[model samples]
Target: GAGVSQSPSNKVTEKGKDVELRCDPISGHTALYWYRQSLGQGLEFLIYFQGNSAPDKSGLPSDRFSAERTGGSVSTLTIQRTQQEDSAVYLCASSREGGAHYEQYFGPGTRLTVT
Candidate 1:
């Protein structure tokens, strides 16, 4: 069985550019999460999707950040007007439905660099 996966493992773009990151969670997993890790900073939760319920976007830093999960399988995180401060490693994880005690399997992550 496949674990979580992301696309465009590395992205380098000029400031103000828009970037889209993708994530594919494991089959049968109904919970997915997105996180960002800035230099010297801890992993920051961005958003989460649980089955067909509404997504939790409270962790998004700003209006420029948004995400969506389709068919409860794949998700996409879009960043509008990218800035140098947005450079970081974006990680995605997924887990089976088991309340708050389930462990999430993490992907390798996509490194974004805004120059």
Candidate 2:
């Protein structure tokens, strides 16, 4: 399918280990976003990338979490020193543009478990 997709649908890592999650957005989409959904919690924004503009990292929980979009297409989110608290579903979404008016297409997400 040409829709947004994430790799390693499920990831299990030991505490203190680093993990990387990947997301592939639909072609031609100029806006990409990363979010996290923890148990019983609402979706938490993580980052946003729009074309060649500087990515918005304000939503990232901490310095341990970082992301990048190469060639404005594929995106990767890296978590350094994984912790149990970081266990959650990492979601990726893409839109035609970086605006609230544009609808975003979401991927199935990558579930991360730190134990």
**lDDT per model vs. reference:** 0.94, 0.96
* Model 2 segments more than 4 A misplaced: none
Prediction 1 global C-alpha lDDT? 0.94
Write the residue-wise lDDT of candidate 2 on 22-49 in tens digits: 9999999999999999988999999999
Candidate 2 residue-wise lDDT at 22: 98
lDDT of 1 by residue, 40-66 (tens): 999999998999999989999999999
Of candidate 2, the 10-residue stretch with the lowest lDDT total is 1-10
How many Å off is the CA of 38 in candidate 2? Answer: 0.6
* TM-score per model over all chains: 0.96, 0.98
**CA lDDT, candidate 2, residue 66:** 94
